[model samples]
Each structure stands twice: as C-alpha cells, then as structure tokens.
Target chain A: MKKVLGVTLGILTAIGGFVDIGDLVTNALVGARFGLHLAWVVIVGVIGICLYAEMCGRVVAMSGRPVFDLIRERLGPRTGLLTLVASFLVTLLTLIAEIGGVALALELASGVHYLLWMPLAAFAVWLVIWRVKFSRLEQVFGLLGLLLVVFAVALFTLGPDWGQLLHQATRPHPIGHENWATYAYYGIALFGAAMTPYEVFFFSSGGVEEKWTRSDLVTARSNVFVGFPLGGLLSLAIMGGAAVLFLPAGIKVETLGQVTLPVAVALGKLGLAIVLIGVFAATFGAALETALSCGYTIAQYRGWQWGKFVRPREASRFHVVIIVCLVLAMLTLLTAVDPVQVTEYSVVFAAMALPLTYLPILIVANDPDYVGEEKNGPVRNAFGLVYLALLTVASAAAIPLMIITKGGQ
Target chain B: MPGESGRVLHAQLHLLDRQLIDQADGHLAGKVDDVELDLDADPPVVTALITGRERITARRIVDITTAVTVSVEDLDLDYYDDWVENHVIAKIPGARHAPE
Candidate 1:
C-alpha cells in the first residue's frame, strides 16, 4: 500500500505539473481550430518528454548534478551561457504566463478580476517557495492538480461521439477553413507545450532537491512513465472538450474563459468549480516550477549554492534569484497583456529552446563519469538521437512558422 | 586528487568550468575558473585549482534589494572567454547551431 501510494502521488504530481498555461492554451486552441489533426503532436511530445526526462533523472541519480549544471559541463561556458540565457528567458516568460493563469483561475472561481488576483496569487506562490518543505510542496500541488481529471469527466459526460473524435485524431490533414501552415504552427505549439524545458529542469533538480539515490531511480522513472502519459491524456481531454463543443460551434479558444466553457456546458456549475481548482493547482504548481527554474538556471550556471533542501539562509543567493524573478513576472503581468498570448509565445520559445537543453543531457547520459554503469542503453540512445533530430527540426522551424503563420494567426 | 589515479582529464573538456563545491562548507563556492598545471613533470600535475568569484553586490532594482553583477574582473575566467569564443561559440554562426 505504501508503494502504491508513492507511485500514485508521483504520477499525480507529474500529471498535475504537466499541464501549465502552455498545455492548457495550446491544446485547447489546437483542438478548437484544427480538431485533432495535430493530436499526434501531443503523443509525440509525450514520448519525447518521457525519453527526455528519463535521461535527466538518470543523470541526477548518477552525478547528483541537475541538467542545467550538465548543460554547462558538456557545452563550454560561452555556448552554455547562450543556451542558459535562451532557456532562462523562455522559463521567465512561462513564469509570467503561469502567474496569469493562476490569476485567471482564481477569477473564474471567485468572479473577481484576474488582475486583482494576480498579486495575491504571486505572493502565495512566493510564500510557498520560501517556507514549504520540498516534498510537501510537491505533494500538495500534485494531489490538488489531479482535480483536473474533471476535464476527463466532463468529456465523458458531454456524450461526444468517441468514434468521431478518434477518427478526427487519426486523420493526418487539417479540416476545412484552416490552412496547413496554421495547422503545422499549432502542431509545433502543442508539441512545445507538452515538452517545455522547465519540466525537465524541475524534474532533475527536484530529484536532487529530494536527495534521489540509485534506489530512487524507479520512483523517478515511474513518475515519468505513469504520471506524464496521464498528464498528456489530460491535455488530449482538453483538446477533446474543445473539439466536441467549439469546433462545431465555430468558436475559438482565445481566453481562459473559452477554454473552460465546454466544462460548464457539459457538467454545469459543479464541474466548473472542480475544473477551476484543478487549473489553479496545476498552474500554481507550474508557476513554482518555472520560477524556481529561473533561479536554478542562473545559479547552476554561475555555480551558486541552489536548492530548497538547504536552509533558506544557506541558499540565500538562490532564494534572491527566485524573489527577483517573481517580481519581474508580476510586473510583466501588470502590463495587462493577454496571458494567452504569453502562453503561445512561451511554448514556441520552449520548442526553440529544446535542443540546447536536451543535447547536453543526451551527451552526458552516455558519459562514463556521469552515469557510469547506468549509461544509456541502445534503446534509450536511439530514442534520444531521434528526438534530437526532431527537436532540431522543430527548433529550426518554430520561428519561421511563427512568422509565416503570423503566430498561428 | 584529480590526477591521483593516473587518470588524465582533458583540460578544456573536463576540468575547466565545472562547479566548485567547497568541501569544508560544502557550498557551491564557484566553478573551476582556471586550472594551473605543472607541465614540467613527466606527467603533468594539476598544481592549483583556481576559482575567482564575482563580488555579490546588492542593487536596488524596482525597489528590491537584489544581487546583481556585470563585471568579470572579479573572476579568473579570462582564459575561457578567448578560447571558447574562438573555438566553441565563434564556430557556430549566430552563436547558435540551427539547420536552415
């Protein structure tokens, strides 16, 4: 029973931590516009992240250093710093978007202006970071994040034709009224959302923060295999919810309100309430993840002491970075820019930032000094190399696609 | 002790720029900024492990007392800038490797 509870908790957190503002917006946007023509991207992205995150966990278990530190080690400082800056900004942008997401969820729940809720939401996130124990923080959010299963519940209750949804997903082409460019653009966005760089950063660093050992590799792997796929399934459920309601009605998902409309349509006020809680926990959890990542990237690159495992004073530099980042993110949100737009650009940047983060992990996973006897087996290396190529293509095409599609129009 | 087992580390590849964790306090003091080697020996010996730290200066940014630095003078990272720029970052156009 203890083992089962551990696996369940790890999976819940992974699934909860999985759907940040990026996944919520991108999957919904794509499903509404393209109607599962790009569902394959979510599947591909899930497998890619599973393969990607597993290596990061492996490296942490072996070397006790997280992926960001490994990024500097494998790539020299100049290149590493370059990678660090790009990934850092992407993470910062994600932090901004997630704060906005939490605020939006609070607004939906309370009917207060999301802008009014922004400061309090950010403060709550900061306080949690400053005081909460690492495991407790993760468990609280992870369990609460499972509240997102309401999306699945709503999708089932909506009584949409499962055959039609699966058929739409299996078909490889865009539906009418949308061009292939827009479809491809959202494909990249959805893929980016599913495999954001912060997830890997949080996973590996969270491993070290929790003091993972060789014995804990199973726990980590279970988190990836069990938790992530379930989270990816939730993303698809959001996509399905959009496909069922918005596509036929010719509605576009441009706001958090629109994203949750299908839930309200299917399950009424109770469903709406439950889904809102899930959104709050998931976004707030991801907000913490991305904010901590901002500190992790800079601190790890500069070799500053970093982690929540140490006393607050011990990792003062890391704490300072986190506080500074949260303030900057809140200021960005204060500009009243649309959080959905932030979510869109952030994920595209995430796709662009992928190769820089993952290449080093793949390279170091094969290094004897790092992984030793636990180095990548042929199956893992094969998947790693394939994802490397795909990531390169996505990174190369992300900007051009954004420009050509006018940010997916 | 890096060379104690008769194991040789490629200077640029392995030794330089790794995080420096101090054994006494076990804080990540800094990174390996430069390694002083005695090539005069038959097998070179790593003589000094150099780590230069940038002073943590608190700047009032947006009314927050935050630590910030813009100088490398405090760091012994002089050798890396030249070598990494020419060999590593310089070789890749735009300092980023993207297949057009």
Candidate 2:
C-alpha cells in the first residue's frame, strides 16, 4: 500500500509539472488557430522529452551529478559555458512567462488587472520556495493542478464528433484558411513546449534531490512512462476543447480567459471557477519549477550547493540566483509585454536550446562511468538517434520559422 | 573510485573537470582544475593540487590554458580527505540529503 501511494504521488507530480504557461498558452493558441492540425507535434514532443528525461534521471542516479555537471565534463569549459548561457537565458525567459502567467491567472480569478498582481504573485512563489518543504510543495500544487482535468470533462460535455478530430490530428496540416508556414510555426512551438529544457534539468536534479539510485530506476521509468503521456492527454484535451468551441466561432485564444472559455460554455460558472484554480496551480507550480531550475543549472555547473533540502543560508548562491531570476521576470512582465507572446517565443527558443543539453546527455548516457550497466540499449539509442536528427532540424529551423511567420502572425 | 579492481581509468576521463568535494563537511570546495605530481619516484607521487578559478568559473569566459601532467594513485572514498560521493548513499527517497 505504501509503495503504491509513493509511486502514485510521483506520477501525479510528473503529470502536473509537465504543463506550464508554455502548454497553457501555446496549446490553446494552436488549437484555436489551426484546430488539431498540429496535434501530432505534441506526441512527438512528449516522446522526445521522455527519452531525454529518462537518460538524465539515470545519469543523476548513477553519477550523483545532474545533467549540467556531466555537460561540463563532456563538452569542456568553453563549450559548457556556452551551453550554460544559452540554457540560462531560455530558462529565464520561461521563468518570466510563468510568473506572468500566474499573475494573469490571478487577474482572471480576482477581477483585478494582472499587472497589479505581478509583484504579489512573484512574492508568493518566492515565499513558498523559502518556507515550504520541497515534497509538500510538490504535493499541494500537483494535486490542485489536476483540476485542469476540467478541460477533459468539458470536452466530453460538448459532445464533439470524435472521428473528425482524429482525422484532423492524423492528417496534420493547416486547416481551412490557415497557411503552411503558420502551421509549421505552431508545430515547432508545440514541440518546444513539450520538450522544454527546464524539464530535463529539473527532473535530473530532482532525482538527485530525491536521492535516486540504481534501485529507483524502475520507479523513475514508470513515472515517465505513465505520467508524461497522461500529461500529453491533458494538453490534447485543452486543444480539443478549444477546437470544438473557439475554432468554429472564429475566436482565437489570445488570453488565458479564452483558454477557459470552453469550460465556461460547457459547464457554466462552477466549471469556470474550477478551471481558474487549475490555471493558477499549474502556472504557479511551473513558476517554482523554472525558478528552481535556474538555481539547479547554475549551481550544478559551478559546483555550488543547491536544493531546498538545506538551510537557505547554506546554499546562499543558489538562493540568490532564484531571487534575482524572480525579480528579473517580474520586471519583464511589468513592461506590459504580453505573457502569451513571451510564452510562444520561449517555447520556440526551448527548441533551439534542445541540442545544447540533449547532445551532452546522449553522449554521456553511452559512457560507462556515468550510467554504468544502465547505458542506453539498442532500442533506446535508436530512438535517441532519431531525436538527435529531429532536434537538430527543429533547432536550426525554429528561428527562421519564427521570423518567417512573424511569430505565427 | 569504485569497487572494481585491475581497471584502467583515463586521467582526462575520470579526474579532470569532475566536481571536487571536501569529505569533512561535504561542502563543495571546487572542481579539479589541475593537479601536480613528483616525477622522482617510481610510478611518481602527487605533491600538490593546483586550484585555478578560470576553468571552473561559470560567471566568466574560460581562460585558455595548456594541460598539466600529474602522476598519482587514485584512492577510494576511504583514503582521501576530499572525495566525490554519489547521492545514492542516502537511501531514503526525498530525504533532503546532499543538496548539490
């Protein structure tokens, strides 16, 4: 019974932690603009994330070092330093988008402008980091985030034609008046959202924080296998709900309010209330993950002590980095720039940063010193090679695609 | 570094650029920037270690430098006052042991 409960909680957190402002914004926007035309990208992205994240967890368990630490050893100082800068910036951009998202969720809930909520939202996220236990933080938000299941419920309530939805997903191209360029742009963005750099850093570092060993490998693999696909299901639910309502009505999802409009229409006020809470929990939970990811990446590279396990003063540099990142994110949001726009660009850039960390993990996963006997088998390496080519293509094409489509117009 | 015997470990692969930790308090002292050894003895003896900040510093551009040759016996966790220990030694899940 205890083992079941332990594994269940891990799976729940992985599912919840998987979605963030990136998915909340990009998935809905794609769903609204192109219906299910780009949905295949979500499947591709989730599989890619699972493969890399598993390798990272295995290395952390075997080497007692996070992904970035191994990156330095494999890439040398100059290349490692370059990887750090690129990843740090993308993570920071994601952190800013999440903080803005939390503020936006608050605005929807409280009927106040989101800008007024920015500082307070940032403070709340930081206070939790400073005051709450890591496990407790994971539990509260992870469970609450499940309220996003409202999208799945609402999708069923609307009673859409299932075959047509599946047909669109299978065909996977621009629908109606949508263009090929914009379709490709959103596809890359969805891909970015699923395989965000912070997820790997946070997962591997979380393994170290949780003290995983070779014994825990089964548990870790099970969590990824069960949890992440469920997370992808939730993302598709959001997209389907949006497609059934917004795409037909010609309402594009430019705001968080539109993202939940389907729930409100399908289930009335109670569902809206529940979905709002879900948004709040998902974004706020992600804010914590990205902020801590900032600390994890920087500290792991510098060999500084990091993690919520210690007194704040003991890991002084780590704490300082988190605080600074939160402040910078808040300041960026205060410029009145759109959070959704930041989210779109962040995910695309996440694609660009993919090769930086992913390449190192793939290389190190093959090394005996790091992964021991748990090294990548033929099947895993085969998938790894496919993703290597895919990520390289996505990274090379993301910038030009973003510019070509004018950020998907 | 491990339980295996009669295995060859490469210097660049195993020692260089790996994290350095002080075994006394588990505080991260630094990374293995460079090492020094005495060549006079058969098989040689490590006289001292060079701690340079540039190679390991994350905040600045890395300073280009030539490699140094060092001859030393690689000791297990029990021998060295400073060492690297995998986070696995703490068996409990989410136990909050070994922050970095």
Candidate 3:
C-alpha cells in the first residue's frame, strides 16, 4: 500500500511538474493561431522528453550520478565547459522568463503591474530554495500545480464537437487561413515547450535528491510513463480549449487573460477565478523549478554540493549560484521586456538547445559503466537514437524557422 | 588497496572527475580533482588522493594560499586533510575497465 501510494505521489508530481509558462503560452498561442493542426507536435515532444528523461532518471538511479556530472566526465574539460556555458546561458534565460511568468501571474491575480512584483517574486523563490526541504517543496508546488486541470474541465464544459476536434487533431494541416511557415514555427514552439532541457535536469536531479536507487527505479518509471503523459494531456487540453474558443473567434493569446478566456466562456467568472489560481500555481511552481535548475546545472557541473536536501551553508556555492541567478533573472525582467515575448523566445532557444542536452543523456544511459545492469535495451536504444537524429534536425532548423516565420508572426 | 593493485591507471581516463562517494555510506563527497603520486620508491605509484575545494583551488590558482587562507585557517587543516584522505578518495569499484 505504501509503495502504491509512493508511485501515485510520483505520478501526481510529474503531472503537476510538467506544464510551465512555456507550455501554457505555446499551446494556447498555437491553438488559437493554427487550431489543432499542430497538435501532433505535442505528442512528438512528449515522447521525446519521456525517452530522454527515462534514460536520465535510470542513469542517476543506477549510477548515483546526475546527468551533468557524467557529461563533464565523458566530454572532458574543454568540450564539457563549452556545453556547460551554452546550457547555462539557455537555462538562465529560461529562468528569467519563468520569473517574469511568476510576476505576470501575480499581476493577473492582483491587477498590479508585473514589474512591481518581480523583485518580491524573485526573493520568494530564493527563500523557498534556501529553506524548504526537497520533498516538501516537491509536494507543495507539484500538487498545487494540478489546479491547471481546470483548463481540461473547462474544455469539456464548453461541450465542443469531439468528433470535429478529433478530426482537426488528426488532419495536421493549416486550415484554410494559415500558411506552412507559421504552422511549422508554432509546431517547433510546442515541441520546445514540452521537451525543455531544464525539465530533464530537474527530473534527474530530483530523482537523485530523493535518493532513488535501483529499488526506486520502478517508481521513477511509473512517474515518467504515467505522470508525464497526463501532464501532456493537460497541455493538450489548454490547446483544445483555445482551439474551441479562440480559433473560431479570430483571437490571438497575448495575455494571461486570453489563455483563461475559454475557461470563463465555458464556466463563467467563478471558473475563471479557479483557472487563474491554477495558472498562478503552475507558473510560480515552474519558476521555482527553473530557478533551482539553473543552480543545479552549474553546481552539478562543478561538483559542488546542491539540492534542497542539504543545508545552504553546507552547499554555499550552490546556494550562492541560485541567489545570483535569481538576482540576474530579476534584473532581466526589470528591463521591461514583455513577459510573454520573453517566454516565447525562451521556448525557441530551448528548441535550439535540445540536442546538446539529449545527446549526453543518451550516451550515458547506454554506457554499461554508468547504467550497470539496467542499461538501455535495444528497442529503447533504437527509439532514443531516432529521437536524437530528429532532435538534431529540429534544433538545426529551429532558428531559421523562427526567423522565417518571424516567430509565427 | 585496489588502486595500488592495478598498474598505473590513466588518471584522465580512469579517475579524473568521477564522483567521490563515501565507501561506507555512499554520501557524495566530491570528485577526483587530482591525485597525489608517491615517488619515494623505485617506481612511483599514486599513494594518496586529494579531494577538496581548497585542493582544487590550490592546484589551479597561483595564490591559492592567499585565497583559501581565510577559509582554511578556520578549519583544523591536519584533521580536515586526514578526513578527506581516508574517506573520500577510494577507488570506484567497477570503473577500472572503462573505455577511454
């Protein structure tokens, strides 16, 4: 019974842990603009993340080493340092976007400017990282993030034609009005949103943080296999909600309000309020994950003690890095960049950085010295390699696609 | 020690940057930054390993003493060095045949 409960908790956390500001913004944007024509991208993104995350989680569990640690060992100092700098810059940019996301959530809640709340939000994220225990932090935000389920509920409440929605999801083409470049651009964003590098960094590190050994591998698999797919469902629901309400009405999702507008249209102001709370929790919760992940990637690379499991003074360098990242992120937001725009660019950058993060995990997971008896079987290896090739193509094309589409206009 | 039983291992291939886990408890102490080789015999062998932030700093920086003196002075240097020497520098059990 206890084992069952643990597996259930892991799944719940993964579900809540999955959607972030990127997922919310990208899914809604694509849904409103291209309808369900690009829904297949979410499926590809979800599978890609699952394959790599499972590999990373297994590597950590069997080897007792985080992904970045092995990355440095395998790639050597110079090349490893290069990957670190690139991954760190991308993660830091995403952190800035997430902080902006949190402040935006606060603005949606309180009617105050998001910029005014940026410093306070940054400080709050730092305090949680400084003081909270790993399990407590995971449970509180992970479950609270489930409030995003309201989007799915709102979709059903709106009572759209399920057959038509299914037809659009299956058809995979720009409906009469949109062009191929914009459709492809939004497809890349959805993929980027789902398979962000920080998610794997956080997931594998969290597995290590929880001390998941070989015995705990089952739970880890359960979380990825069950929880991540459900989380993908939540993202799809957000897309579906937008497809139903925003696409037909010729609306573009520029603000948090439009992301929740379908909820309001389906379930009135009360449902809107509930959905707003969900959005706030999802974004702020992701803010915490991404901010901590920035520190995790850096400290793990340098072999410093990290994670909320350790006291701050004991892991001074880790805490110091996180504080610095938060301060820098807060400053970045204070430059008055639009949070939504920052969120969009961060996702595109995430798409561009995809191969760097995934390739290392694929290499390490297949390595017998690292994974020991539980290394990737041939079938998993085939899928992982295919995804690696696909990720390389997607990453190479991402920037050009962004420029050509002008970020989906 | 298994580290001594083997022929001279390639530090970069076999040891450098691998996690330094406590043999008894599996607590991750640090990584193998650099190894100390003993040349007192006819053929030199790596006698002890150094694993600490200060050691890492001292190896890379010219003025590590000036930099670490502030933090190191507070530490019982002899005891700290002994602790790192005994506990954190053991050989990885299955890492010997790792392909270069």
Candidate 4:
C-alpha cells in the first residue's frame, strides 16, 4: 500500500507540475487564434518530453549524477560551457516570466496591478526555497497546481462540439486569416512550452534530491507515462475552452484575464476563482522550479555541492545563485513588460536552446560507464535520435521564425 | 590506477570535466576541470586532479569509478564556497539547518 501510494503521489505531482505560465499562455493564445489545428504538436511534444525525461530519470537513478553533471562530462568543458551559458540564459528568462506570471495571478485575484505584486511573489518564492524541505515544497505546489484541471472541467461544462474539435485537431493548418508562418511560429512555441528544458533539469535533480535509486525506476516510469499525458490532456482542455469561446467570437487571448474568461463564461464566478487559484499555483510552482534550475545548472557545471537535501550553508554557492537569480527576475519584471509577452519569448528561446540541453543527455544516457547495464536500447535510441533531429530543426528555426513572424505579430 | 589496471583511458573521455566526489561525506567537491600530467614520463601520467582550478595531488584519491572519489579535509576546493557561505547564505536565519 505504501508503494502504491508513492507511485500515485509521484504521478499526481508529475501531472500537476507539468503546466506552467508558458503552457497556460501559449495554449490559450494558440487556441484563440488557430483553434485545435496545431494540437498534433502538443502530442508530439508530450511524447518527446516523456522520452527525454525518462532517460534523465534513468541516468540520475543509476549514476546518482544529475543532468548538468553529465552534460559537462560528455560535452567537454568548452562546448559544455557554451551549453551552460545558453541554457542558463533561457532558464533565467523563464524565471522572470514565471515571477511575472505569479504577480499576474495575484493581480487577477486582488485587483491590484501585477507590477505591484512582483516583489512579494518573488520573495515568497525565495523564502519557500530557503526554508521548505524539498519534498514538502514539491508536494505542496504540485498538488495545488492540480487545480489547473479545472480547465477540463470548464471545457466539459461549456458543452462544446467534441466531434468538431476532433476534426480541427486531426487537420492541421492555419485558421481564419492566420498564415502558415504564424501557425508554425505558434507551433514551435507550443512545442517548447510542452518540452521546456528546465523540466528535465528540475526532474533529474529532483530525482537525485529524493535519492532515487535503480529500484525507483518503476515509480519514475509510471510518473512519466501516466502523469505527463494526462497533463497534456489538461493543456488540450485549455485549448478547447479557448477554441470554443474565443475563436468564433473573433477574440484573441492577449491577457491572463482572457485566459480565465472562458472558464468564467462556462462555469461562473466560482469557476473563475478556482481557475485563478490554479493559475497561481501553476505559475508559482514553475517559479520555484525555474529558480532552482538556475542554481542546479550552474552548480552542477562547476561541480559544486548543490541541492536542498543539504543545509543551505552546505550548498551556500547554490543558494546564493538562486538568490541572485530571483533578484534578477524581480528586477526584470519591474520593467513593466508584459508577463504574457515574456512567456511567449521565453518558450521560443527555450525552443532555440532545446538541442543544447537534450543532446548531451542523449549522449550520456547511451554511455555504458554512466548508466552501466541500463544504457539505451535500440528502440529508445531510435526515438532518442529522432527527437534529437526534431529538436535540432526546431532550435535552428526558432529565431528565424520569431523574426519572420515578428514575434507572432 | 588506469596504468595499474592496464586500462587505456582518454583524458577527455574519462577524467577532464568529470565530477569529483568527496568520499568522506559523499558530497560533491568539484569537477576535474583539468589534469596535472607527468610529461617527463614515457607515457604521461595524470599526477593530480585540478578541481576549481586548484590542484589536489593524486595521492588524495580514494577511488575512480564513474566519479573521482577524493579523500580531502574540507572538500571546499577554493575560497569561493567559504566566501559565499560566510558573507551571504550563513547570514540568513535558517542557513545552518536542513529543512525539516
């Protein structure tokens, strides 16, 4: 029974932990504009992340080393340093976006401007990281984040034409005066939102923090296989809600208010309140993950002692890094930039940095010395290689598409 | 150890940039940022592990499996760790204790 409970908890946290500000904004934005025409990208992205995250868990479980450690070891210092800088910048940008997201959620709840709430949200994030146990921190945010499942509830309550939604999902294309460039740009953004690189860094390091061993692989696999797909379903529901409400009405999802409006229309003020809390939990959870990921990547690269499993004094450098990152994020958000815009750019840049993060993981996962008998098999390698190719294409095209579409207009 | 075991290990592949684990507490110390080589020897041997740009003699090495295990007194390779701890994190109220 304890074992079953552990597996269930892992799956629940994984599902809840999956969505973030990027997923929230991008899905609603895409749905508002393109309907479900780009739903196939989400499926492809879910599979990719599951495959990548599974390999990351396996590596950490077997080798007891997190992803960045292996990244430096496999890629060599010069190339690894380049990857580090790129990944760090992207993660930091994501940190800023998440902080902004938390403030926005607060603003939606309290009616104060989001900018007024930025520092408080950031400080709360830092305090949690400083004082909370790793397990407690993860479980609290992850479980609360499940409130986002209200998107599905709202969609069902809205009573949309399921057959038409499926038809749009099956046939992929630009919709309603949208060109292929904008469609493709949003497609990459959605993909990046789904398979954000920080997810891997946080997942692997969390495994190591939880002291997962080879015996825990079953729990890990179930989390990835069950939790993530269900999370993807929630993302689809957000899209469906937007598609049902906003697409036909010629409304674009430009703000967090619009993202929550469909739920309000479908399920009333009670639903809006629930969705606001859900958005708060999701964004706040992501803020913690991105903040820690900044420290994890840098410390692991430098081979410094890191992780909340140890006392803050023990991992002083790591804690300091997190502090510095939070300060920077707070400062960035104070510039009065739109958090939604930051979310869009962060995901696009995440798309650009995908290969830098995943390529080394793929290489190390196949290394016999690191994972020993658990090295990648032919089928895993086949999918791994295919994903690598796709990531490379996405990375190469991300910037150009951003420019051509003028940042998705 | 590689020479003793008659195993040919490439520096880039096996040593450089690998993690250095402190065996005493099983905490990470640093990376094998570079290696000190005995160039005068016929086939140059790795004399020490350079971690955080500081050379720790190979005699402190406890084992070399996937990671280089080193027996060191402080495992804080450089002053940076201490500086950060003392000046920043340790100044915080709950720095010394692990979260309950």
lDDT of 4 by residue, B1-100 (tens): 3456544668778888888887788888888988888889877777888876577886777787778898887545747887988888888999988787
Tens digit per residue, CA lDDT, model 2, A1-409: 8878888988997787778989988889988888898889999999999999889888877877788888887887779899999999999999999989999888998999999999999999988887687878877888889889999999999999999898888887798788888888888899989999999998888887778888788778877988899999999999999988988888888988998998999999999999999999999999999999998888877766677876565566677788889999988998999998899899999989988889989998998767778899999999999999999899999889888888888
Which of the CAPRI classes, incorrect, acceptable, medium or high, describes model 1? incorrect
Give me the candidate number with maximum lDDT.
4
Error of 1 at A77 (Å): 0.3
lDDT of 3 by residue, A1-409 (tens): 9999989998998898899889998999888987888889999999989888888889888876787887777777677788788778878888887888888878877899999999999988876776667787887888988888989999999999999899999998887678887777777788889999889988889888888899988998988999999999999999999999988889889987788888889889888788877787777778888888888888777666576665454455566678789989988788898888888888888888888778778888877777888888999999998988887887888889888877778
Regions of model 3 farther than 4 Å from truth: B1-4, B7-11, B21-100
**What pairs collide in candidate 3?**
none
Model 1 lDDT tens row, A1-409: 9977887778878888788889999988888988887899999999999998999998888778889888887788899999999999999999999999999999988899999999999999987887777898888888898888888898999999989998998998888888888887888888789889998999999998988888888888999998899999999999999999999988889999888888899999998888899899989999999989998998898877788876555565676778789999999999999998999999999999999999999998898778879999999999999999999999999999999989888
Tens-digit lDDT string for candidate 1 (B27-73): 56566667677789877766555567332221100110011112333
The clash numbers for all candidates, in the given order, read: 0, 0, 0, 0
Instruction: For model 1, state the Cα shift of residue A382 in Å.
Output: 1.3
Candidate ordering by TM-score (highest first): 4, 1, 2, 3
Tens-digit lDDT track for model 2 on B8-96?
A: 43556655666665444455444565645446854543334444432322112121111122222232222211121122212323233
Interface Cα RMSD in Å, per prediction? 16.6, 10.0, 15.3, 0.9
- Please give the interface root mean square deviation for model 2, in Å: 10.0
Give the alpha carbon lDDT tens digit for every residue of A1-409 in model 4. 9999999998999898999999999999999999999999999999999999999999988988899998888888888899999999999999999999999999999999998899999999999999899998888888898988889999999999999999999999998799999998999999999999899999999999999999999998999999999999989999999999999998989998998888899889899999999899999999999999999999999989999999999899999999999999988888788889999999999998898899888988898887889999999999999999999998898889889999999
Q: Model 3 chain A — which ten-residue stretch has the worst lDDT?
A: A310-319
| DockQ values per model | 0.14, 0.15, 0.11, 0.84
Which one is best on DockQ? Answer: 4
Q: Is the docking of candidate 2 incorrect, acceptable, medium or high quality?
A: incorrect
Ranking 1 against 4 by DockQ, winner = 4
